[model samples]
Target: MPDQDTSDIADIEADIHAHLAEIAEIDAVAVRVYQLRVAHPTDLVAQLAERAGLQVAEVARAERHLARLGLLQPSPGGGWVAVNPESAAESLLAPVEQDILERRITMAATREQLHALSGDYLEARGMRSAKGSIEIVKDLGNIRSVIDDLARTCASSIEVLSPGGGQNEEAMRAALPLDLDVLGRGVRLRMLLQHSARGHRATAQYVETIVAAGAEVRCTGVLPSRMLIYDRHCAVLPVDPEHTGVGVALIRDTSVMGFLGRLFAHYWRTAEDFLADPECDEAAPPEEVGGELRGIERDVLLLMAAGKTNEAIALQLGISRRSVSRLVGRLMDRLGATNRFQAGARAARLGWLASVPPA
Candidate 1:
């Protein structure tokens, strides 16, 4: 053989050694048959097939593979013997390793070429192409991609006006992936949840979950529409808040997006925080706010009925007079009474006092 040919064969042997373990584990039937032959090195083909779990043809294939890898070479006389494994290891493995490296290099170069082509394509298309764009998305599947793309590209903040009770199970399941993505990217998320959302079981739970994940959420009595704005660059809103059967509007006009952002900010400040207070759990009984008769509302009512001043009640409860005053206002509103006297009378008339008994 020529000097170059000897060097080339040596290179091939090196790559085969690098990936010998990989080829050995490709298939179960093949591996089992090979292992059987390896364990009983001098066994004849017929006896090996009988002893191995694989079919006759499979054992024959395994034998061919072993011989091709230089692990099973013909003996000096007649049969075969297992060659030195160290000699065979690289001899069989190098070719596979070379093929993998070649393919990886080709794939990486192709990907880079494609990315450069894409950049040229985008440049010709224009970066601020959305200036006057009003894309109509009818399919929910297509809308999901649009939202996901915006979340991935958003640089600064994500503002959302999520109204109409809480999100349905289907919406939660679908949006969770993108929602988590934006939050994890260090984007400031300000969500405006409508007051009606507090009544929703899933919505409340979802709020608690996202709040724990570093999202800012607040509830209000009214919201303009269901919208998601990413960094004042674009906004997505249902064409009609009452109906999504029509389609959704993806607006890229700077003025429209700016207005959407302002609306979100205005509501964010005015809306109430999504509290994790024990009083807020919907699973608790209707009468129990935080604890049975342990609620500030009930305590305030009892104190008011006894003609105790807000300051006196505050001192006894170890709370501020301002809190006691606020509790009085809330108690009156919840009881549908006009004043503290009326609130206390209503509580007594409703058997709230008797339900607790002397403590």
Candidate 2:
């Protein structure tokens, strides 16, 4: 029943409304320019650009847009003339609102229809234990990739055993990026380093950096192998100890992972905090060091029993060489020994050296 001329105007109005809907600010500026053109009838893009603090080219773009929407028209003399705003909104804006609502309803129905396939997806590959979870990654590069993927996917915790604390500078540099990322994610990290780690100057500094980032560090004289357990869901073990570049096995077997977790807990319970008293020998228990000597003196006896020189003892036990000499003298006098070798013998006889590893 609508007139042909009215239908044509209505279609144009809808096009203009859809264009305006894209950006509210642009729409507002366009409409305001229409109002200003009606009032003053200026054809200068520079004038409008100055008023909007925009480039002349930008104002020209808006001008061309409004001209196509019937909100603007070329004047016989120069610039553009504003069209009636009331008629344009009635024809364009009202119909566009209805169009937007209908599109939204159609989109909702489409999404629900797609939802029917979710069960098939779950059956295919949704569960955590999905097959192929257990992967054997060979070569150093692939093994490093798996570790990094685990670090990135890690949501909760990490367990690490470093028998030597840290490797040489090249290895440390290779691992520094991933280590920093894991710590930065606020994942809880519990690491075990060897008691002799402090003796390595570079390793000592590396331990401090990780400790400062909230990782829990401890020392133990023993650990079976270098391992990494992630969230109790995956365990990474080396294929060969001597040549780490050979490869590694990433275990996702739950039972094996659970055993690794239990093993770590056992060691964690007895491992001394890396920041503990410098005089303590975390590698050897206090009872085996004999109940008679002071803690610091026990430290001296344990190092002496291991046959470390005074300089090495000072470095490992965090004391001056001169201080180590004085402490040895005091321990010898206490045991009635006249020299370092005899003092070691007397300490052994007293059961103070029982904890030291046999030569």
Candidate 3:
């Protein structure tokens, strides 16, 4: 009786192995079936044979066997449809079979290593690296992909230097909310725009929405360029004139990113606060005059009051010294003051130098 029992156990193991092999064969057939279903759902036997790498006669025999087992249904017109078994059976086995086939394909690809070879050749030859990643894309589709990826990956901060009214108001509106969601989770955001951006209704609305959501927005006159920096780790620059497409360089190297971060800071420092409404040039009461100073000029006044020179102020604010001098002249005219000293004195008296919490 014990010998008989051992015999039965060996037979069971053999049957299990045989069933596994059959399933492997069926998995190959399933892949063919999927392709056939896509290309010619009406022609089953040919597709199945092509997929199985078997003769048409052999595939027909296998199909008949599968149909007898109710694993496939024959159509009156032609071809066959898979009749999936109980979910439990498929769930238990199909995934393993599918995974095995995928690994096989991946192995085949790895053996050839065509993609990796191209990437390596590009890196080794240094041709791809020299162009700077942002310049490499040179297409709209690639730009969109890079921007979308950056938006998805940003963890803490996103700084944008946009000129000419900034990324189409509609696109900005859609993207800003996603960035705001990240900011809501404690990420910091800083945006710089061309002063001309103020003239556009879409940009104004976008600025208001972002500022209201607690992101910082600044504007500079005649901004020279556009950029988007994500987490201080990657920077994007527009390659196309229309700015519809851009090139992105992912700066993972700490030194490179640090340099880029400083550049962004330089721009941010000089940018005007967009949260505050600019006061109309028409004269108003002292209260209103102080309110107008609440914008970028007010910050400039405070910096000047600190006894910083025009060059120093320009460096700190990320604008040209000429711009600072221009600002100083405007403030002097506005406050009816003679020099920087008197400008500070008048700004203090008018309460313009008080630290305006970043709106």
- The numbered model that scores best in TM-score is 2
Q: Comparing 1 and 3 by lDDT, which wins?
A: 1
Q: Any runs in candidate 2 off by more than 4 Å, and if so which?
A: 1-134, 280-359
Considering only N, C-alpha and C atoms within 3 Å, which residue pairs clash in candidate 3? 134-247, 269-317, 270-317
lDDT of each: 0.63, 0.65, 0.60
Off by over 4 Å in 3: 1-135, 240-246, 280-330, 333-359
What digit string (tens of lDDT, one per residue) describes model 3 on residues 1-359? 45765665466435434443443344344444443544555665776577657788866766665554345666677677665433223443444345445645755566465644644653654544542332345466666777777787788888877766435856776687676787787778888876546657777887788788888988754444677788876777654335445444344445666777887776576666765444334333444555545345755676565446677666655456676777777777778764443455566656665443111
The full ranking of all candidates by lDDT, starting with the best, is 2, 1, 3
Candidate 1, residue 165: the lDDT equals: 64
Which regions of candidate 1 deviate over 4 angstroms? 1-129, 276-359
Cα-based TM-score, every candidate:
0.43, 0.45, 0.43
Clashing pairs in 1: 15-93, 15-94, 16-93, 16-94, 17-90, 17-94, 195-220
Residue 348 alpha-carbon offset, candidate 3, angstroms: 22
- Tens-digit per-residue lDDT, 217-336, candidate 1: 876545657888888888888865678646677788777777777777766654556663423322333354323343444445655554466777666544467767776766666666
Q: Candidate 1 has what TM-score?
A: 0.43
Better of 1 and 2 by TM-score: 2
